[model samples]
Target: MSNLISGRLPAGVRPQSYTLDLFVQLAEKTFSGRLLISLKVEKSLQTITLHALDLIVTETQLCGQEALVSIHPSDETMTLTFPETIPPGEQQLSLAFSGKLNQQMRGLYATEVQGETFAFTQFEATDARRMFPCFDEPAIKARFKVSLNVPTHLTALSNMPIVEEKKVGNLKKVTFDETPLMSTYLLAVAIARLEKREIRVGETAVAVWTLAEQVSLGSFALKVTQAVLPLLNDYFDLPCPTPKLDLVCVPDFAMGAMENWGAIFFRDACLLLDENRSSTATQRRVADVITHEIVHQWFGNLVTMHWWDDLWLNESFATWLACKIVDQWRPEWDFWLSFQEGKAVPLALDALENSRAIQADVKNAAEIEEMFDALTYEKGGACLRMIENFLGESVFREGIRRYIKQFQYQNASADDLWTTLERSSAQPLKKIAKDWFTRPGFPLIKIKTSGDTLKTLHLSQQRFTGKKTGTDLNPWIIPMTLKYEDDESIHEQHILMDKQEMDLTLPVQGSLKWIYGNASEAGFYRTAYEGRTAKALSEFAAKALHPIEKIGYLGDLWALSSRGDHPISVFMEALCHFRGDASRVLVSEICSYLEILSRQIVLPADHSRFAAFVDQQLTPLWKKCGWDADKDEDDEKRLVRADLLWALGSIAQDEEILSELPRRQTLYQARPHSIDASLVGTLIRLCALSDGGKRFDQFIEKLERSKTPEQRDHYLLALATFNKPALACKLIDLCLSNKMRAQDI
Candidate 1:
């Protein structure tokens, strides 16, 4: 171990290219590799330091001669000392090394499914060192030519298309073409007995690979990839960089997905879909995750962040752009509404005192790992969406296209993106966006009525801290859109609320019926209205606002009430106006907020009354959705039915719902495929919660019989909901047992 102060390697020497060859033995769980790295040294030096971890280097040669090697396990680095000074010029370094095929799901690792073992690589952050010795950092970009020697029965894949293959006895040597300049973390290799469904999207060959038995399940993902690739290309005004795009479904994956140059890796649940047994929710997830990795092909791979500190640059852009392209492909999905619902998670997390900024300072590998949280993906994405609204869509699109073209195949910082956008749109963006990227919490805008007329309104901004009043005095440059209606028509006015307080006069002919802040839910900030304004907006929200705006309206009320800024009755009152709303996205938000209120605020003595209130609000919606599925029903209708059934059964505890559960459970057990896919998990959970002891053994049996990853997840989560204490302990034991995958636990 070396006492290196900095987590980064010294700046004098860097790699220009890597030729990595590995011989992997999955049965023996070991791999041996030989690496030849082309380096360019800036100045004369006696020693060169690079990154390596858990690797045994058998031989080291610099410029085809012997060199002294020193391994540092503490900082995961290796130094090679030459007998003579190496002047400032290009040099070649080669090493022969061996390492274990670890089970920790990092670097070169093995995953076992059933009785079969496969090798895969997950090298993001810093684990690339564990595979082979190189300068493993995002800023150090290098081209790679990878070759793998594996069993002849398996298929090997890497960052590029296969260039050559030859058989050597029981093993095959497969060499891939040279990849574009990329970070080491984005280099991937996978070896498995796989089958693929391939399609051609323009010049790019897109394929989804999975186990032979699940090849049919890759159909939906294949279609989604075909649809999204062209949309992304058109949006970026650039063609796909890679000639081949492969989406591999790993059986045991630690992350939802990893965007590895042309070879993207996803968990089974994210990439494989059984249409007959999969829910609309699963379909949406498959689309979103697939599109997200595709977007990264250009945003993160072509133009990467210079350091881990600006990781949000890679993730946030991918998150925002993926939604944009997917929405363009399937407008009927109402994907932005789903985005709004997902935004609440990070909004809540950001309100905590201990929350870190979107662009926090990251030093070591552990700190870099911590940056991949909800704040980086969700909050950062929401902020980007807000900025896009501030700058019109066309302008934002042009700015992004320019940014990609200018920084393609290079490294960039967050400020570089902002500067490019500012130049393209001629908008003063950095002044407004700096606070959002560097600050932890968002603002809460308060709307107050001025005088007796309905034309004038006063607005004030303050940081919103959950559960307490915030004292942070820094003001954000907030973009706001006010929607107000008169007797004749509705109108919109955009404002830049850059101060602590501001007053605006509505441009209405006569009297204003109501004014709703945060129209279209465009801004990331929350809004609070005065009593009269809140009442008027509530009355007109269902009719006047968009479905997403209606959700944002109620979501703000609930958030405000939860923090004691207003009474819980205020949110309850707002719920009444939305009782007749039919959008599944809005309904889902309402159900989730109601469940939270029931758990946190409702008194034990008033439980029955609260239940009755829930029944009154949702029963009619459920009746409209009905107990069965329609053959031609839209996805939203199917989703709404599932939401209503769950809320009515679990939260409201409606007698009718409770009575129907036993019959549904029996039907599901008899013919699970015959049941409505959206209702399967709900039925399983309702049965478990209602008949805990009797259903425990039944659930365990069903879990053992679960065929798909989705079914297994549903059963596992359902098992945790059982009420008995002994059953809870048994569930924990099951989680720790060999039956569960380490990733799941």
Candidate 2:
């Protein structure tokens, strides 16, 4: 582990000669208040003789950045006088500032969500510099001793476990358990009007806290947190580390959740739930998110990262671990399979795209947060699954044990992990590590059924291998898992297999049930089953497989379907088989593919036949869930269904439904304010074709001038297909020059 604190500094962190090291935070809030700062370097080692200290601070906000407000100098320490009545050398001095948080920014800033007022902190960026200063980088680890003073009723929380809580008059003061020295971003929390609940996970007492006003939502979070904790404790081979754990909801939060040692921060929907009518999707989300943050307490909070370049190593493991645990414990939810289609495939494609590489350093700060994209979360997880495949489960678990034991509470790089595994297994891991981490795309593993013997092989594009052979061949450290029907077995082994089209003999006889080439979904290799082997996987997915594999089964079909290489009937048959209670996102993705086929394939040949086939595909499913076109259901669900209806109605020429779409569009567009929704575009596009040029122009004018973030997506869609794409394009340009929201996604 390199220096998360002392490594390359961010912009403005280091000035020409002076340096600032941010440490220590004291929350002196009345209901709501904050502190932000960094310590500055004043005297040189050669000049001071380790005697007196002299430092200056400037561009300041609130308090000074010293560890203690007033420190008595020892015989070995130094002191300096201020140029002004209350100053010293302003150039290099420790500075800490305190203030009431601005609600708009949520953390250091404030945020207002729905109709209720809720305040929480989301200071992961340079805002931590604004909150409290000490070496702010992740590598610059330091033990944190945080103290808070709030209204007697306002509960105080931090990364550390609470050691003391005292009520003095109307104000309550709390001192927390000291945190293992860690980076700034990992230290998170929220202070507000709260209603809380608690449970015991083993010997540790854990709690769920949220806005008092959100009673039903907060209660649901309490259950999910309590249930997932013990299960994870068993799987990870680590007990819940903190004596007390806290999960708090901030509706206005920018990210889903922050792993703050004992205190984790989350967005509203993730931690808060509606008991009576929450959709199936909402329930699955609660599980996935809660499990994700809890795992981070071990992976991210305990074992850290040395630099931002390997940030994916942190996120990808948590993601894979989260979905895996959820699927094992709550198989009914079937969330991982859904993720395979909507999230994983798209990520693999993006990772292979011209602009991206699997492992690259942060070029500049402008795109750091934005860098947390599809590749980091999806493709990275797939790649790690591959690593598990090659290493073998028993050895892989041991490697993790050694890796974490060696680096607990300290930061680590990808190489640090690779070295640990090499030492543990006495095998050269560099070849496989380089192939997976240093490349730009995924690999295609081809499995064929030849006579009674099943043969397997590997293929990749020229760029990935950097090869000059006729087949552009180069060896890859392939980690593959296989599922076959003839054996009724799932081979979760890492095939350190190398070849330029070398065939392999297998133990299979009749057919193959499935092939998880990268066992445990670890690697980024996609499987291609030839002829009859593909048929058996479909049959297994059709009957025996659960939601996760069904989604993967559909994803495999869709990949082949989109390339126009697979037959439409075979694709349709696979879609027909996915009747499980998948996710709304999965259902929506499937519906989209069918509609795309109708518009691009079937419709052009014979419009009436296409319409009939689409109506056939959608009609039964339409009434099955969200076809309340008359608006007689939940708002969020209605909106989700409305998305599907627009596609169906537009293609079928259902003018009755399509004509009223503008009014529905207007209603959806009109939210808490104009900027609260992204529905304007689809509604506008449906109107464009339904009412021709007249309604299109009226809708166009509204978007042309509307300035809220609500209009951004609509404007973008309008920009994509309008009479003049450039007109919409230029307006987007203007908006770009204007401010953008951090929560637009």
Task: Name the top TM-score candidate.
Answer: 1
Q: Count the backbone clashes (under 3 Å) in each candidate.
A: 0, 59
Residues 62-85 of candidate 1: C-alpha lDDT, one tens digit per residue: 865677889887788998888888
The CA lDDT at 539 in model 2 is 66
TM-score of each: 0.98, 0.69
Cα misplacement distance, residue 448 of candidate 2 (Å): 5.1
lDDT per model, in order?
0.88, 0.57
Q: Highest lDDT, which number?
A: 1
Check candidate 1 and list the clashing pairs.
none
Lowest-sum lDDT 10-residue window in model 2: 45-54
TM-score of 1: 0.98
